[model samples]
Every structure is written in structure tokens, then in C-alpha cells.
Target: MALKTFVKISNISNLSDARYCAGMMVDVLGFNIDPNSSTHVAEDDFKEITEWVAGVKFAGEFHDSSIEQIKEAIKKYPVDYIEIADLDLVEKVGLLGKPLIFRLSITNEEDLSKIKSTLSYLDELTKLVLFHCDNENLFDQIDAQIGFYNGNLKLMKGYGITADVSLGNFPGLALEATEEDRPGFKDYGQIMDVLELIEED
Candidate 1:
């Protein structure tokens, strides 16, 4: 019933701040590797940050990039998990024994169908982050999808989750908090509160 918290640190300088805030509770720490993104931290920066924040699980966030690049990053940086937005890249790379979490752009049944088609291939997928891109009523469809996975897959809801709403939800779900989502609070007290609630439940 423990809720795992993942914080995305865009700036490598803020790595210490993130580690300090996260303390000993955070389950995963994410670093953005996309060059065009504002959160983009270089591979060396990722290495330095990971060394500083030892013990806490690490993840690298990637967008539309080549499989070779992704594989290189995984080999060089080597985080516990890799967060990818592209399913094709995931299939091509084959996850390489490392756990993967797909940040999917879910909208309608078609998108879900595509995800379903790839599920059998995503053997390393530990979780799926259902991204709400077009203000769609995704919450309504989640229950059915959860049933479809039948407790085998972990579900993470992204793209509009606030600390308050995140805390309201309980156990067995993953929550990803980006820098843009909550800029001020480095410490994830709100997320920890949610985890505590899940444990209690």
C-alpha cells in the first residue's frame, strides 16, 4: 500500500536541494535528458546528480529519440528505470532488463488499442503513465482499463495531478511530479502524506 513518489529535477544544480527535500522517503528521482526541453540535464550532469543522491532510485525521462541514443543513455547513466514517451522506441530497444514506464498520450479508444497491442511486447513495463493531453475524461475510462490489466500492471496518472488531488488518491499507484507542476516545494510532504494514507488504508 505504499505510494512511490518520483520527482523530476530539471536543473542539475538543484540536485542537492532535491535530495535534501526528498530525504530518505522518495522512491525515485527523475532527470530529463531531452536536449530541447528546459529540464534537459546532460549525461554527465545526470551522473554527478546520481552519485550525490545515492540509494534513492533514479530514472531518465526521454521523448521522441532514437533507440541507440536511449540505449547509450541507459548504459552510460544507468538509472533504475527509464521513462519513455515513444512505444516504438521501447519495442526497438527491448528494455535490456531494466524496468520501463511508458508515459502514454492517451485520448480515446484508439490510443488505448495501440497501447493494448504493445502491452505483450512491453515485458519490462513496470508501469504506464496515462497522460491527459486534450482535457479528455480519462478518469472515467481508467477503472475499465485497470480491470483489463487485472492488477498485473501498475497505473500512473499524469498531466494535471496536483498535490491535493494526488493525496486524495490512495495506495498501489505511482505519482510523477514535474518541476512545472509544483515549483516551490522541494520537499514532497504532500506526496508523502498521500503515501502515508495509502499505508494506513
Candidate 2:
């Protein structure tokens, strides 16, 4: 079987790892900017990354974000895709005419219903990255729901996707890790182990 690749961004500390893992097919990067905070990357960093990295696709992530904030981030950085967790914000930005990567946190059947309705408005999006919380069976249920879409949008899994999970079976699985708890954050050997697991079926 072929290997599945992904990128996860938690804090700015993971940027180095992301840069090292660049050139992979499915790359996930994040940018979180608070209106009054000066912690996250600045505009120059985004421009530098865009010029340095090539051939790798990025999914920009945001949390507790608003439409205006997201739009400003996208305008300054401009990645291959964008990840939004808020449904209402997604609906507001879906009308912007730019393709995005919507990240939905799956919890129950009702969330699926909401996704079905949201898809009707944001069908032009590049893909949907579903973040499953603690429930493995959720993937099976989502796979069935995805079938109803007739392959109109791609499905990528995230959140709680660890080395123990069978991700090889899911072609578009994206691994998400936090800077503090990430297995390979401090050790190269552990990172390779996680990568090996992802490549295995």
C-alpha cells in the first residue's frame, strides 16, 4: 500500500518541524492571530514561507475566529487552503468566492446534518478536514455520509490521529499534534516511528 502524509500545527514552535516536513503532498500549517496579541508570526514570516516552500500544499487553521480576522490572515499569507472550525463563520466566509479547507469537529449525527447543509453553500471548497474526538467509529459513519456527496469534496481526518491509529486505510488522513504532547516534537527517532506507522497499512 502507498503511504499517507499529513502536517499538524499547534503552536509556533512546530514551524520548524513543518518546514522540515515540507514537500509532502498533504501539508497542514496553522496561523492564530489575536487582535491585540503579538505572539504569532508576522506578515513577513508568511511571505517568507510562501517563497521558500514549493510543491507542498498547506491547510491554514484558525480557532474561535471571525470572518474578518480569517479574511485578513488569508489575504496576508494566502495558503493553498484554509481551515475554519466555526460553522457560522464558515457560512459567512464561504461567500467570499475563494476556495477553502473547512475543518469540522464531528461529535454526533446532528453535526453531520449541519455539514450537509453547509456543503450546499460551500461546495466549491477544496476539501473538508473532519476532526474526530475520541470516537473511531465516527470515521465509518462519516465515510457513509461522504458517499452521499458523490465525491464532490475530499475528506481528510484530523484530531486524535495518533501513531496507533490505522491511518493508512484513509488516504487523506492528516495528523494533528500539539507542541507539548506531540510524540516526535523532541526526538527525531520518535518522529520517524510515527511516520513509519502512517506509511503502513
Writing each residue's lDDT as its tens digit, candidate 2 over 46-123 gives 566556655555555666667787777777766656666666676576666665666667777777667666666556
Candidate 1, superposed: residue stretches over 4 Å from native:
1-13, 36-38, 113-115, 118-136, 159-201
TM-score of each: 0.67, 0.66
- CA RMSD of each candidate after superposition: 4.7, 4.6
lDDT of each residue in 28-107, candidate 1, tens digit only: 66667754476677777677657766556776777766777777767777777777877667656544767776666777
Question: What does the lDDT come to for candidate 2?
Answer: 0.56
Clashes of each: 0, 0
lDDT of 1 at 104: 66
Q: Give lDDT per model, in order.
A: 0.56, 0.56
Highest lDDT among the candidates is held by which one? 2
When summed lDDT is taken over every stretch of 10 residues in candidate 2, the lowest stretch is 7-16
Residue 195 of model 2, lDDT score: 62
> Stretches of candidate 2 above 4 Å error?
1-13, 23-25, 33-39, 44-52, 95-97, 112-126, 134-149, 167-170, 180-185, 188-191, 198-201
The numbered model that scores best in TM-score is 1
